[model samples]
Target: MVDFEKEAIIENLSKVINTKLTEKANKFVTADVREFGFIGDGLVSDTAAVQKALDYCESLGGGEVIFPKKQKVKLSKAGYRSIWTWNTKTKLNRAYALLIPSNVTVNFNECELIANNEGADVINLIENKNASVDLTKDSNIEIKNVTINQSIDIDTFAYNSMDSCAVCFQNIDGLVLDNVKVLNTYGYGMRIIKASNIEFRNKIQIDKCLGCNIRLGWQTFIVDKVNINLLVCSDSSNRLTANAVQGNTLHMNACSDFVIKEFRQTTSNPNKYVGSVNINNNCSNVYLGKVYSIDTGFKIQDYSSDGSNQPYNIVIEDMYTEGILDRPLFYIMGEGTKINNLRCKNIGHFWINNGKYTQFGRAILEKSSFVVKGNLPKEVHFDKLYLYNSSAAFQSNGGQDVVTIKDLTIKWDETTNTGSYLKLLDIQCKFMNIGSIVHKLEGSMKDGGNQKGGILSCSTENTLTKIGNIIDQNGVKTENVVVTLSTGMSTMINLAASNIWRDSWLNVLDVELVPVDLTSSIVIYNSFIADTNGQSLKINHSKAKGMEQFRLIVKGYKHIKE
Candidate 1:
């Protein structure tokens, strides 16, 4: 191994670059489309002529092939078998601007190609796999300043999930497309599969795309290092009237290390039931900077059945939604796709739809607002759920265990006008709510000692500090929690006679148990209620046997035997 001086190396490298540039300038010649009998009339078939020019430029070891401005290089409408074909090696599709061969730059400045008639992508990239080993740095394909309009549909590939688009790239490393506008695409605007280091920048806009706007990684490819900045996902007059396209307007499947800086969804095209931003199938290391949408919010889900494919290590910093979504604006489904580790900040609006969030690792939600559409999921768990000023009307479905919340805020939804499910903190500590504050114990608390009833049986499994701390950390206590029971049942927090021999501390100062639409009662442990204003604790509604005497003095309120 020999060390070279830095200055000497730079000088030699400069010399080499100058030589290469000089050689390329002399050898890489450019050709106009008209040089090969090309007629600009839209009626004539300019496929052969265009193909000749491109092949000629490529044969000269890669060069620029410029087309006349605003020329209608339309496909021959008469006696045509296929408008475009996958010309991977033999110059890519013989027609249209589909496959961009290696070391070639086609500038369609102010030019447009009317494609998407037959499920063939307007500009598709099928990399020369036989090139070099490393596709990341070895590939070279750039398409700039072009406008692609794909309006045709192939009946054969109509329902194919990953078929037809404005531009599709497959395993093409080192590809850069700038200032590209995709319009009137029947299917997706663009799709890249098994590719690496592919970038589409400088205001890439997609309009009137019937299907998905942008898609990455299909069935069996792991896409990496993709960046799409200044993206716009819009449709014209809700073109997806027949439900041909579904899921997210922008879909990311099994992709990694990608960033979508700014996405603007101008018009709200619900397409009835499609989500605006959908990321699923084990996508990792993704960051969405800012998103403004009126349609639907972002949904991160894993449709895999075996828990093998789920979203991991993802972040969405700032998101703003303009309209009130009946659905959850930001949601995470952990059915098959496990949420390993994720963090998102500043959500506009949200609601929980009652899904079993079976998370394997940790999840942190900070500075996000949870709009209480209704009740959140029944069995939901988070390592740390920190709500700064979020309005969350949530409760435990008797299945929560050891949850920790740090400084949260709650409010009412002005839309529903129907007040929230108020009564909450109804958690189950291993079938025992030991020393817990019981607001709306479903059935009567089984005389306290009777473990067989619907009452929350006190368990001595935990210490006094732990139980007290857990109840204090409940989202309600810090900001005034009122547990309003649901109507239709007469419940109780029964402090039966059997509790006379045991020591179970109720971790509440003023437990307000009121029903939503009915009047229920809780028979306290005789000394349950002490005073009215200085408000001593009270346990006075229900009763059991062998309660002879009860004496208690708390907060200067004294009570005699009952």
Candidate 2:
């Protein structure tokens, strides 16, 4: 009877605890904007009511600020108040319509926001307390399922602040922007600066932003640890004709440890834009997966304010490009960049500037080519590259320490060939090594063209070697001369006069003498052979029959200094 009484007391205490927990869970309330005097009609301005709803939600220890489903919120103008600054040094004044607080989730519920031709950001993550900005003040904020549209009356929209964008996230930690779409923005679509531990997920699309589609970081602070799933920047109808100069799809500066997957930048007309992707300043440890660029080029430069930073440790996988006829596909000025599997069409170039340890793997160019210009890299390597009907496979300048090309194939067909010859390789370097070169030619392919069937032309100061029977045509040491020979005549020819034997040690292999004048009798026994005495070649005919002219051909191989 005493054990049964103890069990009844414990069960009675559990019921009281469960009743109090349910009351605490009910306190976590979601604030709707419609209850705070928000009208869902598209004609009325709902900026003031939306701001009030966000402020009230944060006062209740941070909850969801939800909008009416499929509502149209119009933000006509911005109030003149400096709540946030762009950076510490510049301290550019910026105004925002909505400022998100800490530990809050603004869920738009697939609603659309329309902004007028005003110079203001639709949303800013940080709320500057005074005239200063702090990098670690706020945390844990998210904005999802919002579509922003900015309407510009071209003549009235003045270019004001640099941070005027659809959405701005600066100096915040633990942030997320998911399922965001921006269209026809006056400035940039999304401006992210000096933020850490950020994520942009579930497909972000920016269409025809006047400035860069997405701007990340700058010269002051470094953005760290960002992951983006998929982003598509496109101008489908070529309507962005009035942009100033910043038309790049994505621009990143001074970023580190970023992994971006499946980014595509395409336009209907290429002449309307400048470039697609620009990763400038001191970005490092960045890996891009599967990028498709149509009618644009990729650039990585060091255009910092002080010009002291350079990017490194960058890798790109599976890139395809087309319709780039004005510039090269890639103009890189950084180090330790490796691109794997590049497929390109149309016509363009590929250049590297003062880079080190750059490599390319498995590239196929159809009606296109690759040329390296500017200050060459320190070390560059290529493996398994195929060029089909390309004008020139390699036209490289500058001097590299070590350049290796393995399994290079050049193909030409009758349907695409313009009856013009192709230049295989022309390079000047310190050390060059080639594994093999195979030509697949069909239908009216000539063994000897305007270049006289010369496939390789290279000049190296140190060492040059080609595997198998590939010979350097610029270093071939063969010369044929005609000299009139009397009974006992001796002539000295300067070996240095010939360009092929200028700095090379001549080793004579074979000598042939053919009589140019057939009417004169010739004596082979009395004819003297030609020999070199380390400086010049000496030829003598001791007992010839008459003054018969004979042609002398000397064939040998050249040996350069080690």
Candidate 3:
């Protein structure tokens, strides 16, 4: 019941369609250097000829530019030394290396743009003096599978002697770089300035560069799957002062909504590398993940000097650091910067210098926050915090907006010989929440060693509320531990507690503690007290109520007969 003539016609039409598709695929252009008047062997430095081939492909509306396998295309001085000075009008023709106009696609696979000189650079993209590429007012550009072996000394180029940036993209949109590797650059590896919707991919190694690895300026950029390797070395014998690498491994300035992932920095020297990553100067909407520093850590500062509505909406999570020295894992000077999840081990110091504007900043240290304070902030917030071998864990001078200390673990190693565990002076924060504590104080009393212990402070105009368990595993007697609460010009001092200990000294003066103000009550149940000389709970100006429920159990105590 089939139409045999119709079936034969359909079969013949299918064969003809298949033949035409094959012909189109075979006719597609594949650029080779030899086809474009490249006569010498592949080892010869024929970058001009190679660029000419690339330009021809671009003129024909974009295609793949292929290189011979296992062969090198050495870039000569004429090809690599081209510099586009800023503020000057320059015309790049199709005769050069594929002048990528707006909305053009240039793909390079199995090709290598190697440096002619063993130590020289391979590609140079200079910004004109007018601060724009002047790409005939075009925006869409894309590049892939390209390798740029940057020059080691870019100062020799007079046009771009001031700031040598390897790959500079300005005033462009929808630019994508994938599977690209840039090595041995004298200046910054890659710079994306004033660009929008830019995406770059894996293996960005800025090894032994004179400047920072990357710089982001005034652009909403998102960097995904980034692996940054910054190795900066210096020899003292050569009278070389190891200048701390200026700029950050990844620096953000005046930009917004920036997300960086898998950021890692490995350096041999600590002092030489300053600030693994810096977020400052009114940059907002930032997200960081898996930030690891092998030898040197990071510093996050807020530079809102003009008071331009301090940067907000910042999150740093899953941070792992090791072998750090004289640097803080997290430093927040901006307002409302939150650190949710962190894991740090074998670090030198962690500091939060809120500068003069201490009343507006907020920091949440969770999962073990440790530090030794050379200079402290006026106010701070700590939750689930831990300290080890650190001289002073909580040190603040007062005038804080808020201070919350919860679930603290302090361990004094035998190596640390100076300062106490906690120190607070003239604090004027609105609320102070302290809960759950374990203090292990160990030292010899031979040479003024036991003079320093835990929770040594002078405070005023703040609430002192304590709840939950307190365990003291110290070898010596717990003495000289004082908590003084007084009032400043403004707010009254409030104190409330339940089931608390008196093993340390507690002095409350010039304050009021009411039940209504203590709705979120501090409940302490079944505790022990072992104060040797100091009073357990000293109430001077006892105007307010709420301290009648504390039960103190004392053991092995010899009180001096008054």
Candidate 4:
């Protein structure tokens, strides 16, 4: 026999849960699009009838508009992809477009909204006639389980709606687009302008478009609090030679305070990347998480007129790339950008920063094997940059700012086409404080191998191997120049040696230990003079310490450099 009290309590709990779930079932007055006159036959101009249904659903103070299963849609309008012409010859009708306004839910039922529409997008929401839109938090629209097909070429496509986008939004405060596929669009796959507090999630795919797959926030639009993730974009490497801009996967122009997660884009050919992902035009406070690319990973810049607009406060983490085919994996032309956990291979430039900033920092670069080249800037905050098979590292050129590296590690590869191991030129004007650097060089010292790491003199302009080759190329003494850590300040180095080549690691950063020559037994000065005129500032090391408390301050100098 069942326990009566226990069974009765379980039944009561089930009843309460069912009541709560029932509240979520079809909250809106649901009706099929066919009921309002859409044939879904793929030939008829079902524009007027479907639009009528949407208008009625909106009038119901927010209801559901359902599209029948196995629907084939083809609606025709004049000048499908033409620019706006207001003359009597070509009258535009943006109202007849598949417009979904505030407080409505659309369920496509896994149906195809086919590309039979001409002149405008097959679907639109809250069209703003002007370039600018004013939005608020009171209204919303939701769409799910739909494929927007724009099966037309530029010859048949027209710039319809507020944006020339096949799926467009303007002045929208709330929108949820889930499980949507935009295919073969003559223009942009989807365009969002002047929006705030929106969420785009769950399997959004776009393939083969003339322009960007998605364009977010026009230059004149004020946008924020937008979260987009799980977006897959591919070019198919099938763009015509006559294409323009090659169509970035997603473009964010002049947007602010956005978060992008789990976005992966791939091109058909690694060499045929046409401006893959662009986030430019004064975008700030942006974060990219779990992003990967085959072509150009990301390009962040500001091309506003007069060069006043610049991007700032950007953070990208957990980006794994095949490296870049044509561009840098991360090209930052802004300020206050932080990157973490970046993994790449032998493709192209890992990162290229061509802007000005007060301070820049990169955190946790792990599991990467490639060679990269770039300038080291001032106030760099980096930690645990473990590089394997690295061909070349940073060009430690002296700039106005003194760069203090936190921790850098280089693991050598014997197959690497060896270049300069380290480039710390003496032209550096400011003091560079490197915390900890671990270099592991591979291969034998005999047979003219490991023949690299050239450090030259500013006076003689010849290779100076004062600090005998740190690694063996072939057993032969390498004529290639070694490190010249000569700075304006004496006793500025505080480095702790990790695992190195051999006993040749003696005079690494020592004032008393002498530097040895590679080919000869010549002993270079522990601290050399700057000029032949002997008009140089000198200092004496009175204390021994570490870099955590190392400080170098140069103030009120007499004659400046020539």
- What tens-digit string does per-residue lDDT give for candidate 4 at 1-562? 1111323323443454334323332347776788888888877867667667767877777678888786776655422222222222453434224666567777888877664543334433223223124234234677788887767563334443333456776666666777889877644677777766666668899876756788787666656666666888876322542544236788887686666777888876555544467778777777776787766466666575333565776666677666544343555555555666666664455443434342333433332322212243333345545555443233333334333445555554454443544332221323334454455555421235554542211221111112212333323432221233333324322221212222211212212332333321222233422232323323333332212122222111111223
Rank ordering of all candidates by lDDT, starting from the highest: 2, 4, 1, 3
Q: What is the lDDT of every predicted structure here?
A: 0.47, 0.61, 0.44, 0.51
The residue-by-residue lDDT of candidate 2 on 258-366, one tens digit each, is 7777789887556655446888888877777788988777777766433357677677778887765545366666666777887877747665655555677887777
Candidate 1 lDDT over 62-112, as tens digits, reads 877788888765643221212212222333221234345566666776676
Estimate candidate 4's alpha-carbon lDDT, on a 0 to 1 scale.
0.51
> What's model 3's TM-score?
0.64
- Give the range where candidate 1 is weakest over 10 consecutive residues by summed lDDT: 552-561
| TM-score against native, each model | 0.58, 0.72, 0.64, 0.66
Any idea how many clashes model 1 has?
19
Best prediction by lDDT: 2
- How does model 1 score by TM-score? 0.58
Ranking by TM-score: 2, 4, 3, 1
Candidate 2: give the clashing pairs: none
The Cα error of candidate 4 at residue 11, in Å, is: 38
lDDT of 1 at 551: 29
